[model samples]
Structures are given as C-alpha cells and as structure tokens.
Target: MKIFDLAAGADGPEPAVATCSRKACRSEASWQLLWNNPKIHTPERRKIWLACGEHRAWLEDYLQTRGLWKETLALVPDTSSAPIGQDF
Candidate 1:
C-alpha cells in the first residue's frame, strides 16, 4: 500500500523503492502496469503502477475501464533473460 512517488525520480537523489500500489496491501510489487491517456498525454508518455499478484488484475481492470491500460509486465530479476508468459 506504500506507493513510491515518481516526483522523487526527477533529478532527485533518492531511488525508487518498489512497492504494491494497492490501497491497503503492503506486499511487494510483482508486476508493473504501463498506462497513459492519449487524450491528455503523448503516445510516448507512460505512467507506471506496481502491483502484487493478488492486485495486478484488479488494477489492470480499473485502468482498462478508463481506456488507460497499455500493458502489464511481470517484475523479474535482472539476471534472468527468460521471458514472462503473456497469458494474463
């Protein structure tokens, strides 16, 4: 439930702490929600929302309802070159 503010990412000194975007769950994030509103944002503009398995789908549905859901990506380790399944 602790959301990392992107404001700390713009020329700031702190690093982004990965956490679930769920309202009440403080679980670690396992997925990334890539979204943007074309009507008010550029095609290249992407906003990110991190979520755990239990909440990823719920968050995606919320964005889909508003036509803002672009893609859902699994959060994996950097050393692994394996691709995540796209069955979601």
Candidate 2:
C-alpha cells in the first residue's frame, strides 16, 4: 500500500498534520493555526503554524490574545482516534 494508504489504515485517529512555513524550520507538525496570509493564501483562507510540543503553549497563548484562538482550536485534530506509534 502507498504511504497515504498505510497511514490511513494503520491509524486509530487522525492527527493534524501541517508543515512549518518558517524558512529555517522543516519539522513535521501536528499543531497548526489557521492564519490568513494575503501574500500566499487567499483572504478567506488561514495559514498554519505546525508547532512542536515545546512551542504549543506559547503559540496558543499568542493566538488566543489575538481573538483567533477559536479558529486555531478548530484546526486541532482529534488524537483519540490516532494510532500510537512505537516511537511514543
């Protein structure tokens, strides 16, 4: 099976996956923010943050203060259904 298929089938719940937009960061992300970037995404679309655990709290706080917390929370994927990997 293809990677996507395997990923889909071998999972309990789907975790949110996103890529960091930072120039120097290339980490695979599970947390993201729906930020709208006129330079890239359309005005109606929000961008993502793809934050690691270390940055999750910080990022959430920043977004919360901006009144974008609801939007940000909406992007969080449900982990309860995701499969636990051996790495954990």
Candidate 3:
C-alpha cells in the first residue's frame, strides 16, 4: 500500500505523478514519510518524503540516522486527495 500523513489535509489537489525522494530513484512514490526537525520546524509541523518500494528503507534509514524521522504512513490513491500547496 502507499503511504501519506494521516494528519495531512484530505481535501485538495494532488499531483498527477509523484516521484521518489531518494536521489537517483525516479520511481513513482508509494509512501510518504512524515517527519520534522525540531530545531527547524514547530511541533505541529510535519514534512514529507515520498518513496518508492525499493528506496523506502533507505530513505527512512537516512532520516533515522539524522534523528529526523517521526513516522511513516501510506498515501491512498484514487481519491485525488492530498494536502494542497505542500512543497518538498
């Protein structure tokens, strides 16, 4: 299944195509890693990192290594729903 933020707003525009966040991996995104840097973002602020199946672990591990990972959640397709105006 795909992943996204449960807290992410569910009524807005979604991209026609999303690519993995991992460098060099152009696969379509199937997961969304929700995270925040306490030093940089507020408590309610959660950032996103989209990942494909192959790079999911690597990207998550990359965040864990930096102690920036908060959680991982699936992004449901077919709804054309996602937080609008969210940027990487």
What's the lDDT for all of these models? 0.76, 0.53, 0.77
Look at candidate 3 and tell me the lDDT of residue 15: 56
> Residue 21: error of model 2 in Å?
6.6
Over 1-88, each residue of candidate 3 has an lDDT whose tens digit, in order, gives: 2244444346523456677888777788888899889898998999999889999999899999988899988865644554333246
Q: For candidate 3, what's the RMSD?
A: 9.8
Ranking by TM-score: 3, 1, 2
Per-residue lDDT of 49 in model 3 = 90
Task: Give me the candidate number with maximum TM-score.
Answer: 3
Off by over 4 Å in 1: 1-17, 77-88
Give each model a TM-score. 0.66, 0.38, 0.71
Query: How well does candidate 3 score on lDDT at residue 84?
Result: 31
Candidate 3 residue runs with Cα over 4 Å from true position: 1-15, 81-87
Model 2 per-residue lDDT tens digits across residues 2-49: 676766676533554454434455555565655553555556765556
Model 3 Cα displacement at 13 (Å)?
Answer: 13
Q: How well is each residue in 1-88 modelled by candidate 1, as lDDT tens digits? A: 1234454465543433457887877787889999998998899988888899999999999999999999999986444433333222
Model 2: colliding residue pairs:
12-81, 12-83, 13-81, 13-82, 35-47
Model 2 TM-score?
A: 0.38
